[model samples]
Target: MGKVAWVFPGQGSQVVGMGKAIAEADADARAVFDAADEALGFALSRLCFEGPEEELRLTVNTQPAILTTSAALLAVWKKAAPRPDFVAGHSLGEYSALVAAEALSFVDAVRIVRQRGAFMEEAVPAGRGGMAAVLGMEREALQAIVEAVSAEGDVVELANLNCPGQIVISGTREGVKKAAERAREAGARRVLELAVSGPFHSSLMKPAAERLAKVLVDVPLADARVPVVANVTARPVTQAAEIRRLLVEQVAAPVLWEDSVRTMLEAGVDTFVEIGPGTVLTGLIKKIDRRARCFNVHDPASLDKALAELA
Candidate 1:
């Protein structure tokens, strides 16, 4: 039988009322949300279930909210489904993957992600940096443009290599703008600016990464029970020390999402279960290989569908 992998979604996958239904029906899931509230000393559940949209979108709030919601969903699903053989997550979702692998405590992961979001926002001034998605372009072609733009005194660089023909670049506003124009000139299908607080996954986030390293030092991270495909290296890592170091580096490094998916595929992961708020990762996995079976569990309905299918 092909091995199974559990993946998690990152920031853009979050939505208002994401975990409300599952949490309301499942005590285990509810407890996860409650734990987050106590850890953060606020009603993170309320913000997630009843979002004002603006507040929930804030980086500090979004990170913890997504982590808490993903954990809550996992609490419900793990009760019925078999444990994943391998685990991975996209960008901020890496913390969720660690929690799934028992590498990071859910409580600690939530708190750390909250702090991480704050540091990222503080790293670059508002409107100073941005990210944009470039479609219908090869990585090499777009990378060359990014390098050329940065060489002209801007700092744009590849951020998320999501899949073939789809990549995201991050850097200063002017740099991103220049790169976007150049990408268009290079025959990119489309270039859309991302609605993000800062230029994440870029060298501009070095300060944020440094602060995160110090915070991680005080946090307890155990070795994983399951191999976790890291975003920075696109390889499975089980050592706590190595995972900790990669977590710090991931802040300013490109998310090798496509590479990570390919690694899992080569390792016989034919089934991918995305246990989080949205189906973003599921779509990306399908894009990587149409033969891959993908399932998403965000609420009670999705949970039922995935459970029945997996069984």
Candidate 2:
């Protein structure tokens, strides 16, 4: 078998009842959810399993909820199959990857991400900032547009470099709108606004990053048992000090997801198993490297399928 890399999904991938099926079928998965509830001092699993859509979408709730679900699925995988050689995650999902790599405990990760989500939401006022995806544009072109627009308006920066032709920009609402228009004019095929409560992974989130830096000091981070590709640097971070620094910078830095995947591939990771609520990372990995094998374990059925394939 080829070297395996386990990936996790970030925000915007959460949905109601995401881990219910797995929880119902697997005692270990249910235990993971139960632990999250105890750690968060709330019914996060309830909200995840029985969301009103709006409530589950709240940043504070969504962040911990998704982390719980992903970690739960990862627990099932570890119990059932061979461990991955490497791990990576998008934005919020990076916490999940760290937990899986034994760099951080699952309970600590859940609590921190809950704070992370709350900090991000409170960083900028709701109506003041936004994010948009610019499709079919090269990174250099998008960077130029962001630079040109930032010169005229509030800070607009690249947030997520998801794949070859997809990049998400975040900033002040007006600045993002201007950047989107400029991107379209600069030959982008489409610029679609994203549905998010706050503008994340942009310079406008510096305040949040500053706050999260303090929180990082309290969380215990150990040397990663498995290499974890970082979001800001697109490189494997094993040292605890570097992990803390990159995680803080990641709040206001571009999520180098495409590059992260490429870096993992270069490091001998040919198969990717995404342990999360959705197949978002799996899809992006496939787009980044068609020859790379990818799989997602979201629920009971998917977990069974993945175990069978891996076994």
Candidate 3:
């Protein structure tokens, strides 16, 4: 009887051969992959179904690949799942959420994400900028540490506010490295460098944001069928023009994941369905509010499990 939401996962959830099983079992899901291959003018489905791992991991390929997989999964999920009350997604997952909400066509979503990935990679020279996950620290303390490091003339800043005690920071190599040291000294449980190509979701990604703005301008957008919690604002945004603007700004802004989930809960979203490659969002939701119901549909097994839970 409570409101429900469909959330999607981002980059780190990708894996080789992610959607092959569902595509084989469902015609709708297969069409999603076929459309992606046609739109991109290459066998992106093959790259996802049978990846070389190395190529699939490239930011350019990874972006569209994850999008395609999540779209395919959503196609199958639609067969039995009821209409969701609202929708949201993590950093890269925001595009998936938009496509689901009918704010953007799937083909347009895939195309721009490919370009978005390349632009982000090109924004900062490889090995010069990166991200690290700092656990067991509060946001205020972490923000202060990042600010001190950035004041020394580097671009350190918070990237993903995933959940309490789990924050990711991004910036120049020296900035991230120094911040990690400071976070440890400040009593963080651990600081682990992430395997990302560049410093995403930080002021350093402004060049990428500039390039992405042009690509988003001509793309068709519609008011979301359901409210979509924006990553930049952690609030609902349904207007097409405003969605376009926030998307561009999202490139250089920290993902307010915790706040977004909390907003949904405050709006009475008691159940959350993660329609993507992994259970990352489900885990985050549990951490944010264990009383909220969480389920996910990735592969057939997970799909069945989720349906049973919903029932």
Candidate 1 clash pair list: none
Listed in order, each prediction's TM-score against the native is: 0.99, 0.98, 0.98
Winner of 1 and 3 under TM-score: 1
Error of 2 at 263 (Å): 0.4
Q: Is candidate 1 or candidate 3 better by lDDT?
A: 1
lDDT of 2: 0.91
Question: What does candidate 2's lDDT look like per residue over 93-173, in tens digits?
Answer: 999999999999999999899999999999999889999999999999899888998997668999999999989999999
Best by lDDT: 1
Q: Which ten residues in a row have the lowest lDDT in candidate 3?
A: 75-84
Model 3 clash pairs are none
| Model 1 worst lDDT window (10 residues) | 76-85
- Candidate 1 residue 253 Cα shift, in angstroms, is 0.3
Candidate 1 C-alpha lDDT tens digits along 81-102: 8888899999999999999999
C-alpha lDDT values of all predictions: 0.95, 0.91, 0.93
Candidate 2, residue 182: lDDT: 86
